[model samples]
Target chain A: MRDSRGAEFDDFVRTRSAVLLRVAFLLTGDRHAAEDLLQEVLEQLYVRWRRVQSSPEAYARRALVNRSINRWRWRARRPEQSLGDHDGVARDHADTVAVRELVVGALRALPARQRAAVVLRYLEDLPVVDVAAAMGCSEGAVKSHASRGLARLRGALAESSLVMPITGTGSSR
Target chain B: MTMNDSDVRGILHRATDDLVSPPGLLAEVRRGGRRRVVRRRAVLAAVCAAVVAVPVAGVLDLPGNAGDAPIASPLLDEPTRGDLATDDGYLRQVRAVWQRQIAQSDDPPRGEPNIVWAGDTPAGPAAYVAHATVHGMTVGFVKPTVDGPRVSTLTQVTDTETDGLEQAALLGPQRDVLLVLDFGQPVEFSPQLRYAPGGKVERTFEPVVFRDGAAVLSVPPQRTKLTVALSRTPVERENMIHIDGTSEIYFPDHKDRPGPPLVRYTLPGAEQVWGIDPVAEDVIAPTKALAEYLDPVGAHTHNGSPLLWVYGATPDGRRLLMETVQYDDDPSHVIALLAGPQLPFEAVASTTADWSAPLPVRLRLPDDQGVVVVAEGSALSYRVGDGQWTDAGRNAALLPATATEVRVTDANGTTTTVPVGS
Candidate 1:
């Protein structure tokens, strides 16, 4: 029975790791950091597979977001590391690459909490309540983070001549 | 021109469109999971053994039937003013307390026990020690007194919630210790030190907004007055003046460039002040070699015309200056001139491509002396004292010496001169 459960967990990991990686990458701006975050969440999920198996995807997503945000906070309190010039733009097309760099740079510039809110709300398309749950904050707090984050991103993009307007009440889509 | 909600959403989706998990990720995760499971089981077994032994030992020591002598209580002993002056001494005292606790326990501390002494607290000395347990990592704080060290309540720090403790030294002669427990979650942290009288000071970074190439931080319900001082000339106290709740701090892209500020504040009713580096990104000198080269020269520069100007130092004690004329069609033409103690203002190199404002340039001196200039938006070019110009790609170049002034040629074929000095 334990071997069968392990096989089942392996199957879940093989299928969901790719989707989770994208979420982790967006949460953390670096690919290597993203993988580390995903691996950590997966390890925890494996330990509590019996309880989390009912909705493993949601559990994994929550753990990923929470851990990534926590890591960001830890880093902020500590001494800052050198900022590299590379923006991980490895696309063949120049225009697409420029836009990607701009978006990623702007996203990274947001404060840790705000960035997490923005990624969960827009990128992952999670509702405000879900985002709040994932971030360990109230729904109202999540809305505030997403609103402020969107405003900052719009302002940053405007500086680069890529103007974006923040609209909507930041509710569930 | 205006991007709507969908546009912003689309941009985010496109940014992460290409990201995919790498191979062998699952296998690695499985191995780590197995290790964690094994550690958990070991800790559980130890706990169960301790539970059974505690009752058995109690029964064995029933009133008069003394098979075992009464365990000497370390706490009952008179407190000694041990030498807790140095940090190492304080750490030793903390470790001794942990060893005593483990010896008394039915099951010894599993895994490698590690202890870190933060510093001397008002209570005496404080340290954070951790040992492995069946559940996870068991973390405990050692609060020392004149008598000896006492272990505070132990908290389990699991792999998931691994945000640890921070030892912040408060201002005063006593140098009271402030232990900050950061649980890597998004909850607000209002850590209060026993020695501090003021209501807890909550530190939070208001959302970051960039204005005029500077990051503006806003903290609401203003608690303490903040002063942003440049790290290079901290004594100058040329603070970035701001309103009560909002302050604008600049993080310069180039390390040599002035104004990566540090924020200092004192909590209300607290006599001592604390300082922290506010910028999230590290500020390193753009080029170590170029910065070293410029150190001796002490060069400085300002543009006479709005078009172009350059001034900086060389590795040796020589100053440099360069000026350029503004060209309408070809903004990239940077007229590099060598003007110092020995060299005249001779045009050394120029770029044919269009360049942007704030033209970056580095001077190579003593050896293959030349100026490596990066016209913004153009390729980096290197030229040795009026020699053949070589394309050195688009990255910033390190030159042997610093330039005192940089000159540029304008579209009207008019040359503008600028003064650069150190």
Candidate 2:
């Protein structure tokens, strides 16, 4: 018989991969790297599908955070590999590409944990509790990180010509 | 413009609305899941096998696949080496940190973490040989982050814990590293590349520093060929732990120079091979192997000249580029890739590289992304079925998914068309 777990995992990926993929892309700010990250996470989820099937999205989200944080580690030591901006342009959004670059750069520059927290809080639009869960930290800590990240991104935007109104002390909403 | 949460989401959405999650991800995940299962079985067999001279922790060298990522380092019984090895003060500090972790943990460690090796890195003083027991152990990589000394648990092998051992790397909240480890065995650091092109195994090992039980290797920054050896001795460059998905950042002094690369083809060209990134080096220079392979093809760019070429990039920006290594000893179209913008350059696509009859390489970049293309020659271009030819550019390019043929033209204007598909 076809494996029930495989079917379930397949269904989850088929249905949720779009947003998960977007989460990864926003977190890494590189298209290929995002796909790579999502694939790896999904692969792990498939292996542990039985255990995490109940909350596969939560499990996958946490794994994404850990891996992105690890990517930060990778960058520190294995600096030869990095996010290349050669062709990350969205043809339909050419007008806002410059704005997106500023946002991505500001986001990418934050501390790995802070970046994870902020991306989860803002881009994924997860609650502070969910961000904290994904990041393996306290909700209070998530708020602090997101606040710092939002402020920094705002500061970066303010300094740049693309001054995106990404201003907030933190994601109070 | 005051950015709110909606603004951020809307912007990020617009930026990536085009990335519709590349097709066949489920299939890719399944294939990788199967591999992981098989790898687990293999590890189980290896562990359950009769204990020999050393633990047979050799990563299974599946043809055309990258090695498994190592998270826990093998327990070291050998003597330690690190300038900080003798530093009682720093050692005490590192130990105190470990102790602090042990004292604070809800689920405490079985025993004190044995500081296997300690070294003064460009980052700061770091230690190896983390919390362990007889059967399994947790790899704790301590690094000086902007915050403080954080002990990020990488992974656990059998029963212990491991987040993902970045052995050559000291993983924490701050760093991700790839490494080779030997559990409960000692393999000295002596790299001997049996680099022969004619049916002989070509292996190039990065320079490794061994401490008591832990060893720190200087991994090549360039795209490297995976070396899967079954030798129990260190001569085979055994127990290489690799991780995937490395990308662009600076801080060139990440790894200690493992002497000089095999060959350096720094061609002065206006064409930005990698666009102001560091020149790609043949860390495992292909001189002899390269000559043998290329001489047969009768295809080469001369004078140790290196030409950087782009395979095609995805509209969302993922691309592959290779540099032709034509070094000493009449090097011809010898191949290597500059991976992405700042990824390591592995010497080749696979072990069975034959330039005479060019073969497509099945690449498993660290990002877990795979792309296949016959990335070769000085200048290349491709075309789909009955379509216009687009500049493949440089030494090689990722074959477009719909590409039916690749037209390879040398500087001499001799053109050869090879049917290509991914």
Candidate 3:
């Protein structure tokens, strides 16, 4: 009986690992850290597999966001490593690389809560309510964080010349 | 080109395009999960043992007294004699006893063990550990004696008024451990312990008072020396006062106040302190009342200095008075001067006009490296070193470490320059 349940968990992981990994990558802004974040979430989910298996995707996503935010907060107390050192991807066009660098740096510069709000709102395409649920805050808080996060990112991108002027409001999704 | 939300999404997708989880990620996670489940079971068993042991030990007083019993058989599987030699070994022994306690009981909920302290106790070598349960945090003492490892539940340190463990410390020559049970309120009361060498744990009814948000305990090598100081910057908002500050522990004999404080609590810059002033009278009146209250009971003034007093509430809403005596020749003494049933906040507010305002001290900075200080007046200004005095807005300010002097000006245009120690 336990074996069958384990098999089900294995199947869930196999099916959802890629999407979860993508979300983790966007949340952490680094491939290595994303892999670590996802592994931790999966391990936690597995420990309480009976309950979490019912809503595996939702539980996994929430855990990822929470653990990512925790990691961001912990990293804030220590000296940060240079981003270029952790970029595992091969260099492509210099212009594209510079643009990617600016965008990633801007995302990292936002406070942990704001960064989480942006990742959930844009990359995961979660609704404002769902993002709030994932962040363990209210919908108004989510909207406030997202708005401030986007405004900061816009300012950063403009200063770096990575993108054109940012204007107009956007829905959370 | 201004990037819209869609463009932002597109860029995020590209950033993560090449990322892939390791091939053995699933296997690793599964293995990690199994280990976590095992630990969880062990912790649950321990909590269950504690919950059951509380009543049985209370009724039967099992294992007799610590001094009388010949070393019983190893309660836990760990090597007691060899392991008790080192701190790491002793902690492992402590963990083993905790695990054994859990293993002996029926299935219970799992929780984390906060190892408060590991050192030589009067009962030999011991470690203080606490685990949370559905009810509250249960503190335990694990002692590794020549006979075997002895584990006993100290007491349930919290009630429904508070939910979790905030801070803990083992103080005094007897290694009396103090546990702060709640942090939700500005004022916190911690239970102190008196450990008889033979495994007898007696809880002194007199609680350690933490003024503002400060909880600190200091126990020097000399058994007679102990000092507890609670200091914080007072902030008033929304008709209530917030007491948030740092706590420092000092020995009375240390004239130069050498080295760093034994313990310090630095709250975040953004965390608000909130609580009602439990005392009804004016600050001086309350101080005098408290002094008169303690005088008959052997509480004396520390020299000629005015008695410094702080009033707050326990988790259960009881009013508590904490006072300190500064002795010129001897070390300063701090105690929980008085405690009584709840006082109505409304009644207190009605009588006192400035109960929520900052305590009046011209300027009070940390005696150590930091130049931050809490001032009393509204139109307050401060200067660090010989620099121009900047407007400090009647709150705390973190100045440069190289600062040589601190100057503060009050709303009435009175300025005072504090002499910085070399």
Candidate 4:
């Protein structure tokens, strides 16, 4: 039974790590930082694996969000903390790399909480309630943060050469 | 500049499409977890021992134990350990950085920082075991440079956190090479990292003395890919296995979730066997009406595990599906097919490998039927032979038989080539 549980946890990490890593990358805006954050969370998750087996994905999501926020707060409170992002990374003009960099740059500009709210609501397509739960905030806060985040993204991405205007379907509630 | 939620969603997916979790993460997690369990057990034993021999009231009144005492942080209790622990000048420099950073921080520590460990590493001058506290939580710190010290990369010192085998890639004084490794075990495991950046693969072995489970290595700044190998026992340099995971140019694909449990779909007629299950349901009907007209394909199978079938459809109101097929003295394979009301299902395409992520199931039908692609993100597209892309419907798409690549484009015009390579 213990072996089975271990196998199950390994399976979860193997199957869901890509999605989870993507979420971490979106939250932290740096691949190295994202990997570091994910390793830390995975350790914590392993410690609590049995309790969260039924819905490990949910637990992982919440952990990622909380840790990202905590790291941001720590950086703010401690100047020794590495204040790094994608700013110094060399730009890749290749089709895929360029677009991804532009998108990440736009996201990195937003505050941590707003970034989380926007990523959860729009990128992950979680409902307002779920987004609120992930970020430990109310639905109203998620909506406001998402709205403001989307506006900021629009303004930043508007300057990109490949930007395209999307018609509002009003379906993304 | 105005964009809708859909636009943002697409761009976000585009941005993160390439981020894959590093390999060996599970191993690292399990290792950390075991350490934590050991720490927990040790703590419990210590608590029990303390209960029996509770230190005298005043003796136990340590700096942090007594309430609101104007003493140094509790982290200072442990004497610093490392080769350079006695170097006053180096320790002073580390202390200065810690004090300056803490002073500039919003919630400054109540006392001076403790310099625990400082020494030269492959990544240059590095320090670990430097401790500080805010709000009573002890955080461990490591400064890797004399130029700019960024201690944020360090994990906090805690009851459960492992003091052994701390591994991190940190920026050093040069800012060009940043790698630090702590293998908190007594064994002298030789660590080698193979780096191949679109060119010839080179194995770089780090040189170090494992002083109390800490070693630092330098990895150049420009790195395209990395492979890791650690030997439990030291071995000759030439005898070690050199080709460690360099062939795996990219992450192995795995599904986010297992497919629906294989159930016996009984229509009792004649279900034809498609070479494999429909990989991309570019067009699919909700009802199993297509399956209703086919023969009971699973019933006919006489060998191996029972066939698992997933049904789908095509654009021209035809039946399409993918399923498992087994042959005499042969391993089972997944096949896709196309059929009409008047025709029996015939094998169109098949994949001999397991299906999963950072990639999609890509199968090109026999005789140029078309290419079918099933992937994570919906709203995908495919193009064949350098032709313009055609929408694959939703998460799955069926393209012309000549289609060589599957591409997903966000609303913001970012296109990602879904992994459909051979």
Best by DockQ: 4
- Candidate 4's error at B344, in angstroms? 31
Order the candidate numbers by DockQ, best to worst: 4, 2, 1, 3
**lDDT of each model, Cα atoms only?**
0.45, 0.50, 0.46, 0.52
- Per residue, candidate 2 scores C-alpha lDDT tens digits across B62-102 of 32133232224435334455667788887777777777765
Per-candidate TM vs. native?
0.35, 0.36, 0.35, 0.45
| lDDT top scorer | 4
Off by over 4 Å in 1: A72-89, A161-173, B52-422
For A1-173, candidate 3 gives per-residue lDDT tens digits of 03334456765664567568878776777755776677778878888888878888888988888888778532210011111222223325465456556667888899878888998898778899899988899999999999999888877765555454333211110
Write one digit per residue (lDDT tens) for candidate 4, span A32-138. 67766776677678878879899888888999999998895322211122112211121232755777778788889999899998888777788999888888889
- lDDT (0-100) at residue A147 of candidate 2? 89
**Model 4 off-target regions past 4 Å?**
A1-4, A72-93, A165-173, B43-422
- Write model 3 residue lDDT over B282-303, tens digit each, in one string: 1212322323222111101122
How well does candidate 4 match the true structure in TM-score terms?
Answer: 0.45
Where does the lowest 10-residue lDDT sum fall in candidate 4 chain A? A78-87
Tell me the TM-score of candidate 3's A chain.
Answer: 0.74
True contacts kept of each: 0.27, 0.27, 0.25, 0.34
- Which regions in candidate 3 have their CA more than 4 angstroms from the true location? A1-4, A72-100, A159-173, B55-422
